[model samples]
Target: MPGRVQGKVAVITGGASGIGRATGFLFGEHGAIVVIADIDKEAAIETAKEINSLGALAIGVGLDVTKESDIKDVFESAAKEFGTISILVNSAGLNPRLPSLAGKTSEEIWDKVIDVNLKGTYLACKNVVDIMAKGGGGSIINLSSIMGMVGYNSVMSNGLSPYNPSKAGVLLLTKNLAVALAPKNIRVNCLNPGFVETPFTETLTSDAELYDNLVKLHPIGRFARPEEIAYCALFLASDESSFVTGAPLLVDGGYTAQ
Candidate 1:
């Protein structure tokens, strides 16, 4: 039998590593023509090659979601290569831990995080809406965080953290887009994951004490694996979620329940 998303096309940003990479692999396994779009061109290519090696149709495209030109080019290329886009996973993001944010003014950090995490999502969705609508509708999975729903603990951050608000923006964006596009049959939703063990969290997880503290926050007693999050994305992307839209599906191991 064919896979759940057989013959569909999926474009994933930040597809070079972590949750995005894992999602790319899963999407490919499910028979989607996967497009790995990332700023890390080489890694994206390698990921696409790996997917192809697994006997799946896949391609890699360089994308900087913060740039409109790059976003447009990625969709255009995917459309030209694989036809209409059926799924979009906006997984590209940045956190305050990025070395570039060190010593930067609060305004600078806020702008940077919001640009990549929030605005980038908006841009990708804006660019793909037409393609998906024209193709008879599709699914859009945005990556939000538990922080988007609740305030960060003091252990995570003392005052307002830019990452928190940026993710919150993503959740709202997902909702707004979902509502607007529901009439067109396009489903827009977001995944609010707890702390996940990804390259993006290496800085914090690398610190043994911090890692332990982080784990304690999640009632599940551990941080999530990338594949764990990928599975959630898979459900949202597949037809199994045909009735789900504008929802902030929490895969946070009960972190927000407390």
Candidate 2:
């Protein structure tokens, strides 16, 4: 049997690690030519190499998602290299540096969090939708969080800053873009993940007790591995989800079921 995404071209931001890296590997294994884009140039290259080891085509790109020109260039290069892009996965974002709401939150930090988390998604969609549209249609997967679903007790010493709001913004962005691009045959969707054990989340949940407590918050009493989230992204990025759009598919281990 052929792969689900055979011959497709996919651009994945934050592709150096965590969900992005995991998704890159899976996409490549299933036959999509992958473009690994990240701010960390070396890691991006390494990830591309790792994906290439799976016997699929790939390239690593250093990019600042906040820069429109950089984003445009990524899509342009992918189009030139692969003919046209059919998939885009926006997975680049970060939490504010750990600080109490009083000690860590600042105008600069707020802007950084929102700029990368929200604005990055906005730009990726703006830039890649056209590429997909030109190809008749395509799929877009926005990385949101369970944080966007409701207020949670954020342990960031400086507090939530713009991370929470930016995620919430992505939820709406997914919806609006889904509606706007539906006529063009493009599909837009989001994944709202609960706490997953990744290098990025380790800073917050490395504590055994705290991590366990976090787990208990979920009906499943465990955290999702990065691959779990990546699988959700894969489904969204594939034709299997051709009818799905404007939906924030929650993979929270029942964190929001309460």
Candidate 3:
């Protein structure tokens, strides 16, 4: 029997590490041609090599999602190499801590976060939609966050955290794109996950007390693994979610439930 998403082509942004890397591996395991696109060229290349060593077809491209030229170039190359794009995973994002924001002004912090988290998603979608449509429709998975649905805990962040608004924007963008592309058979959706064990959260998770406090926020009392989130993306990317679109699937370890 064929694997889910067999023969589909998936391009995952931020695929050098974390959830994006995990998702790329999962997609490859399920027989999809995977493109690992990230700003970290060396890491992306290494990831693609690892996937290929496992008998999967995968490639790495240096992609700065915040750059339109880079996004266009990556997608175009993927299309040329793998045929019309079929799946897109917009997983590139940022969540700088207070110290990282220290030197930067509020406006700068907001711009950096919004540019990478929100504008990047929009640009990736904008570039890939035409390819997906031409391929008779496909799946586009955007990564939102539980914070998008609810404000972060006061201990975790201030009320004005740009990460929250950026993710919230992604949630809305997913819905809008889903509705607009339904007629063309393209499915647009997002995943709102709680804290996951990824490089992005290393700063917070490295501190035992902070990690414990963060885990306590989840009703499940633990953080998510990258694979757990990847499986969710696999479901959305496959035909299993044919009827699912414009939906924000929460895989939050019951974080939002509390």
Tens-place lDDT per residue, model 2, 156-194, is 344545778899999999999999999999999999999
**TM-score quality measure for candidate 1:** 0.98
> Which parts of model 2 have CA positions greater than 4 angstroms off?
98-105, 154-160
Model 3 alpha-carbon drift over 4 Å, by segment: 98-102
Number of backbone-clashing residue pairs for each candidate, in the order shown: 0, 5, 0
TM-score of 3: 0.97
TM-score of each: 0.98, 0.94, 0.97
RMSD (Cα, Å) for all candidates, in order, is 1.0, 2.3, 1.2
Q: What is the C-alpha lDDT of each candidate?
A: 0.93, 0.88, 0.94
lDDT of 1: 0.93
Question: Candidate 1 on 1-258: residue-level lDDT in tens?
Answer: 888889999999999999999999999999999999999999999999999999999888788999999999989888887879999999998899877689998888889899999999999999999999989999999999998999888887867688988989999999999999999999999999999999999999999998998899999999999999999999999999999999999999889998
